[model samples]
Target: MDCLFEILCWNVRGLNDPAKRDAVRVFVASLRVSIICLQETRLNVIDDFLVMQCLGPSFDGYVYLPAIETRGGILLAWNKSLVNIERVSFDSHTVTGEVVPRDNNRWWLTTVYGPQTHEEKIDFLWELAERRSLCPGLWCLLGDFNMILYAEEKNNDRLDRFIMSRFRQFVLEHEVKDLYLQGRRFTWSNEREVPTLSRIDRAMVSVDWDLMHPDAILQALSSSVSDHAPIHHSLSAAFRPKRRFKFESFWLNLEGFDEALREAWVCDPGIVDPFRRLDALFRNAAEYFQAWGERKLGNIKLKIAMANTLILRFDVAQESRRLSQAEAWLRKVLKLVVLGLASLQRTIAR
Candidate 1:
């Protein structure tokens, strides 16, 4: 039989969207994996996956992605049956997380959020390479590394020498290898006319993990909602696919809109169109209003889909420590240390 205890790393975006993150979850759920590292939960204090969060009784959840940032960090969930609980740490850069199993287990599971830029991302990868030297033993690093290692990863951009160098360094230094490529090399892209495909998001393992799970395989699900597809790969002796979203037709199902937003998006006609960024606002608002009206969305989640029109206003991290109520609530809700785990429990989109 195929090996079990498989792990998945995905950019779910938000668990609330049925067509988006939820679709990806369905694909992962089919895998029957053990641990899942989720990124870009985009959750707020009020957001909840509800029934979706209760996947496994023995699993422990960790939510390092602050809801305030809504995009920069991550959420991790692991089955207790697979590994004993121990310690977990989120990096100061909001780009890496380390899970050290209890009782001196010779393994480290880290989900990395690589830097976004050409330079920053390489720096982050080197940081990973450096970490490998500091901590010996089996290491499994996965998630949206955000750097395409090859030209085949993107359709138009030639292989970036600098980017390639950094990735190679990490792999060479850590003795890491990619899980078998499942399908198309591209794991992420903006589904547009040209359709950019890049394999920036991936899972990697060191010699130790490779030996333990020689049968490991990395498969990318179709882009359903988010820009990144869900990745399912086996590790050790277990395999569990991420949960798929069963979208119910309801306005509450559509997230973002709080009790019917009546305010129309005001397009400042004064803005010029030459620069794509500045003119994007008006175009999106018009698009949102049109989509909203066409759908006649009654489901809350769908209604919130209109808010997706607001998604382009991307900021790396919201850094909401300034929000007193939000911070207090986090302290009460997330017990990463004593409990040894907590989870944002976001659903899949792409």
Candidate 2:
């Protein structure tokens, strides 16, 4: 059986807005996430209907902590088919649970939303440590810790040594390790005139949990509607088939492409079997197109830049004196070529 499971944690800021909720739905669906941990939902309460709308019908069960006034909240939702919830515990700042997979392998998951004030932050750390002690099994802790692990995790700000020391101590005493991140260095940004960035949101697993899922990886996704970027955790050995290359529409715009395709397709070395002949034709076409693309369209951006430079030079020349018939023709041709290339690129992207 495949032992691969994917969990996503995000400080969505607020899911109260319909647009933000839709964005969350789209993002989670795109990733094919199995479990979700959301922080700072800013909703006093979330019902089954709202969960269905936000996470789609796949997630049938959820445990959440309601926000206080306008502050912190935590929510944990899972697909019933993929995970079996053994128990759930929640406070103003956290939601902790024990989940067993179909294979009967069990693990503890805790999603936290640390307090902003220093004293409350200290209390939050100790509470986390206490939870770690209670759940003596493979454990995964994730969400907005509201603090940085290291000085480098924060940008354009002075690191608070006392806070960092305590946070470091908590991790050391608990024997938790970060599931190294990919994509961006920072997870949260203060959307200001001159922004401050920090890696406040993360996934940390117990030593045993690390051994259980050795191939686990964490990816930092782009922040679309919130100040914090979402983090996704999954196993590296997850099954995915190799993607087949498709012919791009832009390739048809290049010179000699038709001739190259025709030559590759018609080159028959007296092969008799229909299946074998078809395979050979396709192989030849792919090879021909790859070689042609490398030689002719090696770098589309560089070619576009060169064309732009030529156009600028001609414009400058026209300012000095009337252009020659050939120069005028060259300008018009360059404009058309630039437009064509840009349009082709857009079409290929889509």
Candidate 3:
């Protein structure tokens, strides 16, 4: 299938805060991925409004395994315009669905949020094996597995060898090829002086699935808030189309709007005739408005990116030492800025 299909798997830690939701939505919009698999939502209920907070309006279809009293949760949302879900089912740890992308055949996608305890981890693997038997066709799995296949996957060089062996054996027996992460070595981190980093999140596909989507690539994306880095899996490397420019009505209410337009109109267009001069004046005013809008309003996307960068900087510093009161407050303010800008972008798009 040459049709493009992309999935974003993230362990958001929690989605209860509006700022966190806005950050997720902004990142999701930038990537333009068709499907989203979020783990550890920690929300007892997943509603349309809550889902909108993360995926926006386009991704209207979803199936979630709710959190157990503020614990684990999994949410799988897809854009209906890009992919049609034939069937969807969920359990305690996963949300499985049969997805059919435009001009492509159907395949099974399972978004997992594995357990932490060793006993629970064993059961999680067993459940996956059972699910694999049921979905014997083209299958692809992605999420925070909460376990690594090798010691090198962790920074501390420490792991339960027995558990690692079992996980590796499962992958081999099931023929689930663990797709190589293209951008980063580790996906999770514990922010501390002596930090622990591990590659717990992954994207794995069955042999037949790989044969169908040979061009598929997995990338570890940077996260602003979450401890786990989101992984993006795509079958094609297509660039997203640029958004259409529109004159925002809110711009007309700005303090210097009239003064700016008058200044542009007064500019000489090097024209002699009165009629031609009038046309030139209008052209100049249009150009002025576009430039003025950009300056006054600023590019929301760029502002959001800057805010994320600042937040990440603060987070990285916190790994070694606690931020002072001023820095902590500034970090919180930056998050709010991101949330507000994201909401503004949505309004402009609408």
Best by lDDT: 3
**Candidate 1, residues 13-50: lDDT per residue as tens digits?**
67555455446555655667666777766554322353
Q: Which lDDT value does model 2 have at 34?
A: 74
Error of 3 at 51 (Å): 1.2
Question: TM per model?
Answer: 0.57, 0.68, 0.67
lDDT of 3 by residue, 208-326 (tens): 99988878899998966899999989887656586444567877788898898678776574678998888877777777787898898788899999999999999999999999999
RMSD of each: 24.9, 19.0, 20.7
Q: What is the lDDT of residue 178 in candidate 1?
A: 73
- Tens-digit lDDT track of model 2 for 1-350: 22668888999998888988898898888887778999998888999998987899999989889998878778789999888676788765888899788877788989988889899888988888888788899899999999988989999667777888999998888889987898889999999988999999998999988887877889898887889998888854555686555777767778887887788685487999999999988888877777777687666677788899999999999999999999999999999989988876777679
For model 2, the superposed segments whose C-alpha errors exceed 4 Å read 236-350
Span of ten consecutive residues with least summed lDDT in model 3: 237-246
Better of 1 and 3 by TM-score: 3
Write down the worst ten-residue block by lDDT for model 2. 235-244
Query: Order the candidates by TM-score, highest first — what do you get?
Result: 2, 3, 1
Candidate 3 lDDT at 16 equals 90
Q: Which ranges of candidate 1 are over 4 A from the true structure?
A: 1-3, 15-29, 44-58, 92-106, 236-350
Least accurate 10 contiguous residues by lDDT in model 1: 341-350
